[model samples]
Every structure is written in structure tokens, then in C-alpha cells.
Target: MSIITFEHSFFTYPQQIKSLISEGLVDFGAWYLMNDEQTSRRFEGLQTRYPDRRLYPFAKRDDNDDIACFDGSDNTTVHVIHDFANSGWEQKEIFPNIDAWLEYAEECNLQNESS
Candidate 1:
């Protein structure tokens, strides 16, 4: 019943995503996916706009891949996982949109409340 709020959507390669999941950092609860080009542009824009914001690239496949995951949080925060390809990544089955994710979260919350 936890609610995860994202100021932006994250896009990365398969291996990095897998590592994140394996590390228990981001659980596949709910998530959104943007195309690689869109993600790159957005990431660049954010970097230019907010130079002070510490950006951590979430790369797990030997750090040579063009794909990257960025973390702009202070502590290790959980993100809803979505759009994962079957490249040896393990995650919980969940929807791939904000509305559906929120709906599921709300349902779980309501169930907990009733119980």
C-alpha cells in the first residue's frame, strides 16, 4: 500500500535495471517508461537546469553501456519498476502507468483499512 511519487520518469538499460531490482533498491510496484531518446533529452535538460542536483547514473552492466539510470535522491528511495525487458531481471508483476499504479496502491490501502 505504499505510494511512490515520481517527479520524472527513468529509462535505462536492462542490466542496470536488474541490479537495482536485485539490490532491493527499486521494487516493481508501479512505473512509467520513456523512449531512449526522450530519456536522454530529459536527463540532459535536468542536468543543465539543475546543475546543483547530484545525479547518480544507475548503470550495472560494467559501466560501459550507453544506457544509464539516474538517482536524484538523498537516501535510497524505492521506485516503481516498469518496462523491464527479460534480460535476467526479477521483479514483481505490476502495471506500467501512474494511474493504474495508484489505483492498485489505493486498493491495497483500502483493504488494509478495512481489515
Candidate 2:
């Protein structure tokens, strides 16, 4: 079963991301929506140390051992940073945008249900 829990009230996430969570659109395993601080702490060198770009991490993939996924501010793409001590994100884009990501998440959850 997929669970939606929000505990990081001290920080604010993107508007579209909040909408997806509120509307019950996300079910990518256990979505651990973390604030900037928590995300930085968990992901280590990848997020916090990168001074040149903005990476706002909001969730991790529980099924995938909490691989951190974050929002890249300039573009509509959400990036996946799978490695620790890496200054920048991996070359592949996690999702094109929030809307498309949510749709794919929904599909992934549905597939999990039939498994």
C-alpha cells in the first residue's frame, strides 16, 4: 500500500508538487517528502554542496532505496541524483515536469498493485 505523510512544515515546496501531494496523485513507493535540510543531510554531498545551481529535493523513492529526486529550478525537469559525492545530477532527467511525473507515478503505483 502507498502512504502519504507530510511532516516538514518548516519548509515550502514547489506549488505544483504540493498540488500533486494534496490531490493524491503521488504513489512512487513510499514518498518521503523532506525539506531542504533533511534532503541535504540524507543525500550528502550531492545536494547541499552544489553552490552553482538550485536543487530543491522534496521526495525519495522508497522502493529504490530512497534515491533522491529533486526539482531543478530553471527548467521544468526534475532531476535524479543517484550518486553521493557527486557535485551535479546524473545526466538523465528524472521527469520532464511535475504533471508528467505525477502521471507516470500513478501508472507505476497501479502496476505495483497488480504485482
Candidate 3:
């Protein structure tokens, strides 16, 4: 799989995200982190779709296609954007950094396995 590296032009991924990608630990319960190529496409698509928001999409929910992206100006902050919103799109600050997001993802996986 294509991993985000320093050469990536879209955005400089925070260390937490880079480490996870390097380790090949992209899957987290219902979410799947996009490879470098997918991320590039997703970023370009979002730029056209929502010019007002600067999002660097890295992961997405399999169930509803909610996007997990980093703030363009600040790679550390992560947000989940609603892709299927009926009355336009909505976004929420779900994690302070990629590390927190990974923790949440791992927790969800554990919960799923328990069930």
C-alpha cells in the first residue's frame, strides 16, 4: 500500500499518522485509512467539492463514508465530516491528533470483537 511520506505534496502528515501508516496499521474497526494515492485523489475531490474548508482526508468510515481528515493549516487536529448530509455537509472535531483517533479506532475494534 502507498504510505504518506515527506515527499507527499498534499500535506505533511503528522508523526503519529506517518508512524501508523509505516506500520501498516490503517484498518480500525469500520474505518480504513486511504493510501497515498487515494488520499491525493480524495484531497483533490474535497477541494473542488468544498473550497471553503481545507481538509486532508486520510481515512473514511465504511458504513456511511464519513471522512476523517486533518485541518489543512494544522495537521494535528482531526475532524470527521459527514459525506451524506442531506442539507449540505457537517463536520465535527472528533480528535485532537492522529494518536487520539487511532486510540478511538482501536477501541472500536475491541468493542466489535467483544460483541
Poorest 10 consecutive residues of model 1 by lDDT?
Answer: 59-68
lDDT of 3 at 81: 80
lDDT of each: 0.37, 0.55, 0.75
* Candidate order (lDDT): 3, 2, 1
lDDT of 3 by residue, 1-115 (tens): 4655534676777777767767877778788888777788878877777777788888887767678998768888788887545424567547987878877777767777898
Question: What is candidate 1's local distance difference test score?
Answer: 0.37
lDDT (0-100) at residue 30 of candidate 2? 48
- TM-scores of the models, in the given order? 0.29, 0.53, 0.79
**lDDT score, residue 86, model 2?**
50
lDDT (10s digit) by residue, model 2, range 8-108: 44334566766666876554554445544656555454445565645555566667633435544443566655544355544344777766765665665
Question: Which ranges in model 2 have alpha carbons more than 4 Å from their true place?
Answer: 1-13, 21-32, 35-37, 48-54, 66-72, 85-92
Candidate 2 vs candidate 3, TM-score winner:
3
In candidate 1, position 20 carries an lDDT of 39
Best by lDDT: 3
Clashes of 3: 0
